[model samples]
Target: MNKDIRNLSDRIEAVFPKMVQLRREFHQAPELSFHEEKTPARVAEILQALGLKVRTKVGGRGVVAVLEGGKPGRTVALRADMDALPIQDEKVCDYRSKVPGVMHACGHDGHTAALLGVAEILAGMREDIAGRFVLLFQHAEELVPGGAQEMIADNALDGVDAIYGVHLWTPFPYGVVGLRAGTLMAAADSFRIEVIGKGGHGGLPHKTTDAIVIASHLIVNLQSIISRQVDPLQSGVISVGHINGGQAFNVIAERCTIEGTVRSFDQEVRQFIKQQMERVIEQTCQMYGAQFELKYGWGYPPVVNDSSETTRMAAMARRIVGDDNVWEIPPLMTGEDFSYYLQKVPGCFAMVGAGNEEKGFIYPHHHPHFDFDERVMKTAAELLIRSGLGYLSADSPEVTVGNLYR
Candidate 1:
């Protein structure tokens, strides 16, 4: 089966042009979170054209396509996120987004295109393959309460076996691939803090409680949660991204607001940080004689990959990109809703490098100017193909996620 899977490189090569074309098309017309309509329609159209059993409007806007092989074995699933970001495209290229202020800033267009390429290649090899293949084209990965959970609730994973997925990462150079046995990404959560104080003329410092000054102090003090509260060996980050306060230079503001995100790998650490943050908020407000409110919302859990599946997929990746390029990288602070899928079944989430310095494709993801060397899409597609088939060819142990940190 490995030999047979290797032979699909020519097939992957043959489909590369179409993959680029599809990516560019999706890039030109991008869609955001829940507003996705035509993208999933086109996805269903493409999958239906390939003669697979397709389900649409799944869990809201997700699309699922099932391809059954001639020989029976187990069912394996491959997932790709289909939504774009709210960022406006800044690059001056032919395929730059047509939709104003909506762009595929994070390379989800490339993800969907690569998975479609895999479907095309595998559909042609159906007679020679065993087991079934489930292709999940999910929506709303950028926003929390993501499509993964909704899709799962819609019975997208009502099957017999394992799953696999990939992300085209720009930090690593083209041809390099990365994954870890434990947590690959962090659990993302967000919060909003409001400080209420007495207002007075700025010239009279003693007359006002000064909410703006309190918010500024709160921002600096919150870092202590990660530094002093959380264990030094463990990882945690509290970044305040947004803040609002006074209206005029001469006036002392009565209210101020602060908003930001929290990222961590451990559930207890996540909760502990929140508790410590609340403690800091209460103490700081009391000292300033200010009334305060804290609103915290939990997002996706951390993405933990199965040890056995990740090991097998890493061994498989060495064949395509060589042993040196296969990476067991440190866990990322980024969040992924794919964690929801891994919770229900055993699977592996892999990352393939799309950055290339020579071609000037070095922009990080989610930036307005973000873009990657499109050539790596083929490598990503091949990895998905090989991983999905490899999982089904042999009896794999049930997924067991190891420690949060290596």
Candidate 2:
């Protein structure tokens, strides 16, 4: 590794314990979605102490901190999601959620702490940098369509040249970071199908067209859209998450509801799946003599990384953690709101390893018992710093808007 990068790693290691403390504090006081009032206030106070210009409530509890460098160059952004899930805490740690029904089951506590750690380090090394550093503390990540879109609408990415974000993944082992050049995460879109039919006695089978029967047919046909309509190589998922029909067995309900999500990495595939879903729902309802209504909800776009930015950041990560610590993992079906920022500006989102077997902290995201090893806090922070600095220092633009659209 390079000397400067090694020195930065050592510096982050020295401050690792403080980052753990910050993470624990956040873990104990978890907040949900747009209601992250206390969380963003605490973050703003910390960033202000670090000598950065902090702005609060950018887009409903979203915080953006600007740290100007000694010299003028491009602007770069580093982001962390600050919202917690609605699950009750099941872990017996000292920092268990004090909120009755809210928990940091997705490791967002670690994400916030890691970004704060970067702010501290960059504040101290302001002279070494050549451009502005924008630290984004985003809210409502778990919500569909995400807080990122709101943040962008508020001109959070106006002057930003590039951005970087990370998720603390417990599936990978400690000391290993996973990344991909493009389409690191899939686009998550939701659909709801409501079928209306005549209500009649269950004994009179021929008297009414059953909505429950029509909903069942719609579910099966929706599954076939991915298998028969979409290309097998281009991945997509259509799962029926909820089905509600008649309340009692004796009565055929007048209405039935079917709701599910669609996930895909490619935009074309996403559109195809949506079109096929509507076609199947409409045709099946017609065959059963029922009225059908479909509501397709759009979520975050796919997180497609800029190759140049990812290559540069990966090299920096290998320097901070080691060549053996970095892995080129395949794209995931999970969605991230950070994809919105990447859609506006060129950026990359990487994963930080926070799994530790010795402490039994290996649960996947959103699980009730999910927790992460606090030791990885420093590593995640250092990677963000390195990626931001490296991208700002690069001669050419990491990614252009035209390239990203393509």
Candidate 3:
């Protein structure tokens, strides 16, 4: 590591306590989706305290902060999502969610706190900073049409050369950094199928079309699209997360609603899944003398990391943690809105290892029991800050002027 970065890393240790406090506060009073009323205000306050220009209520409770460095160079943006899931907090720690059904089960609370730490360290070194820095505290990443798209529409990347973001992952061991060049995460899409049929008395089953039975058959057929239709080598998932239908056990329901998500790395496969789902639903409903309505929602695209940016991030990660700790992981079917930013700029999205078996922080993201070793927050902050500085210092031929510093 260079002397300057080594020194900066040391100073980041001083803010460790603050980072832990911020993360705990976020975990305790977790907010859901677009309802992050209190979180954005706190983010803005911290950014303002760091002497940076802060904007609030961006893209629905999202916050953006700008820190202009003394030196002139390309601008880099650092982003952290700030939304919790609707799952109940199952942990017994003092920092457990006070909100009954909202929890930071995805480690987004840590991501937000780490970005705040990055903002503090970067603001302190503004005089030495090679370029301007944009700090994005985004909201509603857990929902469809993420805040990143809204922020971009609000011109968040108007003058940014490159952007960077990270996910604190639990599957990997602590201190390891995961990076990939192309298609790091899949594109996520959702669909809702409402089957309409006739209801009748429980004693006379012949009179009812039976929407529940049609929905059941539709669900079983949908699995064939992935297992038989889609290529075995290609990746795709069709999961039914919700099923709403009848109230009473004896009543033959008139309507049944099925909601689920589809994930794929390839656009063709994504489209194919949607097409097959609609076809199966329509055909199955028709055979059962029922009508169906399909509501398909397009979501975040595949997160494809720029080759140059991925290479640069790998180097930075290796410098911070050893080379052996920096690893190339396979692409994931999971989705991230950060893909929206990469679509507009040359950037890399990575996963920072937060799993520590001894610390009992090894649960997967979005799980009710999900948690991570807080010490990884420091490592994440340092990697982000260093990568921003490094990207600003180096110029790549692949980063075109059309997408940079607009």
lDDT of 2 at 294: 88
**lDDT tens digits, residue span 178-228, model 2:** 898988999999888889999899999699989998998888888898889
Q: What would the C-alpha RMSD of candidate 2 be, to one decimal place?
A: 3.9
TM-score of each: 0.95, 0.90, 0.95
User: What's model 1's overall lDDT?
Assistant: 0.91
Q: Residue 373 CA error for candidate 1 (Å)?
A: 1.0
- What C-alpha lDDT do the candidate models reach, one value each? 0.91, 0.86, 0.89
Question: Per-residue CA lDDT of candidate 3, range 249-301, in tens?
Answer: 88999999999989999999999999888889888998989999999999899
**Relative to the unseen true structure, what is the C-alpha lDDT of residue 281 in candidate 1, on a scale of 0 to 100?**
94
**Candidate scoring better on lDDT of 1 and 3:** 1
- For candidate 1, which ten residues in a row score worst on lDDT? 397-406
Off by over 4 Å in 2: 1-5, 200-208, 249-251, 395-406
Better of 1 and 2 by TM-score: 1
Q: What order do you get sorting by lDDT, best first?
A: 1, 3, 2
Please state the error at residue 57 of candidate 2 in Å: 1.1
Measured by lDDT, the strongest candidate is 1
RMSD of each predicted structure: 2.9, 3.9, 3.8
Residue by residue across 1-406, what tens digits does model 1's lDDT show? 5566768888999999999999999999999999899899998999999999999999999999999998998999999999999899999899999999999999999999999999999999898678999999999999989999999999999983888899999999999998998799999999999999999999997999999999989999999999998999999999998999889999999999999999999999999999999999999999999999899989999999988778768866877888888988999999999999999998889889999889888899999989999988888888888878877777433223322222
Q: Give every collision pair in model 2.
A: none
